[model samples]
Target: MEAATRMSGYRRHFSDADNEFEEENEAEEEYLDDPGNSSTSIDHVSSGAVINSITSKSSQSKKQSSIQQNSNQTLIKEALLRGQKLATNSREHARLTKSVTYWLAKDSQPEYAIEKPGFKRMLKAFAPRYELPGRNYFSRTAIPTLFSETYDKLKRTFSSTEVSFFSATTDLWTSCAKDPFLSYTVHYITPEWQLRSACLCTHYIVEDHTGENLKESLLEILDEWGLDAEKQVAITTDSGSNIKLACRLLRWTRLSCFGHNLDLAISKGLRDYSIEEVLQVCRQVIAKFSQSWKKTRDLAKSQAENDLPAHKLKTDCTTRWGSTYDMIARISEQQRSICVVLATD
Candidate 1:
């Protein structure tokens, strides 16, 4: 009987635990099903808050990133502007102007070239913010300043004791406009044994090219440079009567230009009947090719095929016999190409 009572007690305990578990589950299901429940509403509000927090953080991060990018761009733009301003300042401007003047004088280009639209465009492409000077500035101010500085420096060099005696070479030539000019170049040895040469003057001759006129002009140049007349060892000049007479009047040792004499000798020798005939035929052939663009192109093609230099045919100058020799030599060098092109014609 006691054992049966113990079993009944155990059954009662398990039946009570099962009833409690079913009651808790029914309460949880009721809470989930009810839309108006406070606990469910609180959970929905918490989830929405988490989503809003994430969205706000993301937006703020993107905004900061955009602001940082804009700041970087602004800094770069400011740095560029500062650099451009520094480059175009007065000091740099003057330096660049001097460089431009030097380039123009060295290349023998006209001052007006800087003012051309194409040249200005090129400068803009190189340095967009830097402004180039006008032609008037280069021609008047920059060029004269450069000349004065160079003249002073050269005068100082000539006055130095390192250069004691110098030999001079002078020549007179007429420009295409019929304006005559005289040029004098001086050569000297430095104390270090370096042979140096410089053109002292190229003055325009308003008067005739008489011996007296040339002598006076030369003396004036020598005096202006503070060059001692006694220190001048010799002067080399062509075989012109007036120049020789001027050198004689100066009483300085005069030397005939060897190149000019050689040219003269070669020219005299080339006057032979057989050589003249040959040169005339060569001239005719050169002229024929020069006159026709088609033949010139064909000659270039033939030269490539023959593995020869792609040099154009040279025309001899009437005054320079060396050029005549050069013309004949060039013809000889390209003989195969010339023959091939002529055959095509």
Candidate 2:
């Protein structure tokens, strides 16, 4: 391409002067030997090749500059669009609209005049604000652009660190109506040794929650953040077969729920094998209490007299895991009394 651009000028220069051929080659050779030659030598040159080369360089430079300008403009436009989507509500839309407006104002064409009342009205109308006046703009906002900028800066800062570690916790549970859900939490630490939110979150939403579906979601999360599962340091989850398999695939350190472990061990070791059987009975007893309004009311009276924890009539699997742990602790501690009550029935 350089040679082609320089060809036209070479043709033009040689057409202008048919002579000075040897001296032109000598001058070109001298310039090659020592690049310190001033523009005076180029001006004196009568060679078409030399003039064409200079013109080619200028043309290439202009083309490069134009390409760079277009790239930057495209990047800003995409950033504005993607960043606005991350805003959660109408208030967020207004704030982001103002930001885009500010960038547009950089064009500074006579299209928007500051002195005009109409322009002032438009600016006032568009500039989204809050009572505190900057929370929307300044709070812990997550924008794709911010992520790009932060990742770039951190890339420079931590490129030398070889052993970056990341971890994730995941679990599966049946929701109300027996629909299943798989949840994952990502955890990572910065090169500075401070904890940072993982680049992944929530569920990867699929048609149905199955083992194959779970494997796909897990792989998708890692792929999105450019994470290698082999690099994961730890994973925490319940003792579900699918979860155990996924962790094994990643070859990470696995941790079972210690509370579940304790329950299993206690049930296995207790002298009164009746405790396990009693729990099965209590499960039905709890259902009886929860079956209708009347039973719930009677249980409430008993709770009131004994100053016991309130009994929620509704049956839901939605309580946090800690709630189950607490219930187990309570039943284990009150086993003697609970056993007597169940036996009398």
Candidate 3:
């Protein structure tokens, strides 16, 4: 009974609205037709005004009602679309947060989670309503929880008897700030014979670079991860005295990194007097031009005049043989430009 009363009230409200609209149109026609408004009648006629004379009042009423109905329909559609957008955004907010956290973790971009310029712009375009997680929030909370969950998953993956044995590689390097870090990478074959490699961990080495210190760190990491040292196949590392001694102390089969050995061999072979002189000259030429903006620009102009693509000379890394080879190769390619720039100077 209450619903029927509400339905009648809605019908009465719409009926009153339609009647008021029709009354306004009738009054406008009457005002235009009045002799007092004769001056405006010419303006109405210029606009091809019907003035409700050609069509009867009922017909005019029906046309106005149709327009009002169309407008109401449009308003309803807009409201529904707005509602759907709000609902979708609410549902997607959680998922987007999780995905962003995971992406930052996987790419080792914890700093990106902080509100930087490009990062904020990206979020504004994709999810304007979402708030970006802070760097501290990710580092202090999100990353640790994510690590715990991932640790459990990896433990389940490696618990199978089929994955009994695994190989690991360790590298210890000093950062630009002179802080030491150690990285561990694990390699294993799945049951389907697919080879997979994963970096298990990278952590700061607060202790000194001694064999005993490294051995203790490795043992602690393995024990934490529940990795069986007896099931380890071999450990590969660069020919660092400390690492070699550590592996020997652990009684694990140690292999010198093949790539490191190859780099050393190439470095030794390139130590001839003639080769050294040529490389020294190339390095000097590159270093002089790189230090001066005018020289670099002049070299670029020379390359353009000679119809050659402008390219920068690579700086050699004394520790890396590959970088030295690349530096020489790039210098040789841009030899004509460098000579022209030097000749002008």
Number of the top lDDT candidate: 1
* Cα lDDT tens digits for candidate 1, 166-201: 999999988989899999999999999999998988
Q: On residues 1-345, what C-alpha lDDT tens digit does candidate 2 reach at each position?
A: 999989989998997675577779887788767756655566566566778888999999999999999999999987675554434457765565445444433453342344457755674565423221232343234234455665675444333453376677887766567666667666777666787653344563545655566778788767755666777787777776776776666566898978666655654564376765665564665576555666556555655666667645322232343443455565554444444444545
- Which residue window of length 10 is worst by lDDT in model 2? 130-139
Error of 2 at 276 (Å): 3.5
TM-score of 3: 0.73
Which candidate do you rate higher for lDDT, 1 or 2? 1
Which one wins on TM-score?
A: 1
Q: For residue 104, what is the lDDT in candidate 2?
A: 35
Best-to-worst ranking by lDDT: 1, 3, 2
lDDT tens digits, residues 92-149, model 3? 7557766777888888785554568888898767766566667777778777888888
Candidate achieving higher lDDT, 2 or 3 = 3
